[model samples]
Target: MILFLGTKSGKEETKLLAGISCPYCKQTNTLSAITSPTYFHLFWISLFKVSTNHFVECSHCKRAYYKNEFTPEMRQALGID
Candidate 1:
């Protein structure tokens, strides 16, 4: 028998914070908060979360930006201090 264990990474849209103008698409009310999780998996099942990251994505263009890249207003809307 063989055991399979490894790490897996995935992104999830956590919430629809206040919509804002998107820099890439030049659109309004398109940015949202997304959460990315890297985790340890066993037999295709996520066992434990190893780390987490936050991002801002443009719904219109599907562009993603790291938390640090988010503007002050965006971070404030997301309740990130």
Candidate 2:
């Protein structure tokens, strides 16, 4: 996954833009890494052009997100700004 660091509300941390999180578990408090050629290729294809995609993970819930689900602070992290 493509990783970036950004500051949110005056706090800095790392996050994934196209990472996957387990949806079944929401409070496991564990985070996992995911990477695949198709996923990476899609992200690059969209990023290289004028498209923006955001992927988020919930360590506590293992849930993932895309697009509108991303926070404004995360936009800066993934170079969306």
Tens-digit per-residue lDDT, 1-81, candidate 1: 999999999667577755578777888877878777899999989988998889888888899889778888788887889
Give one clash count per candidate, in the order shown. Answer: 0, 2
User: Model 2 off-target regions past 4 Å?
Assistant: 1-53
RMSD each, Å: 2.8, 13.3
lDDT of 1 at 21: 82
Q: How far is candidate 1 from the true structure (C-alpha RMSD, Å)?
A: 2.8
lDDT of 2 by residue, 1-81 (tens): 775533222213444434333445633324432222122224223222222234556666657656466556445545655
lDDT of 2 at 34: 28
Give lDDT for model 1.
0.82
Compared to the true structure, candidate 1 yields what TM-score? 0.66
Q: Model 2 has how many clashing residue pairs? A: 2
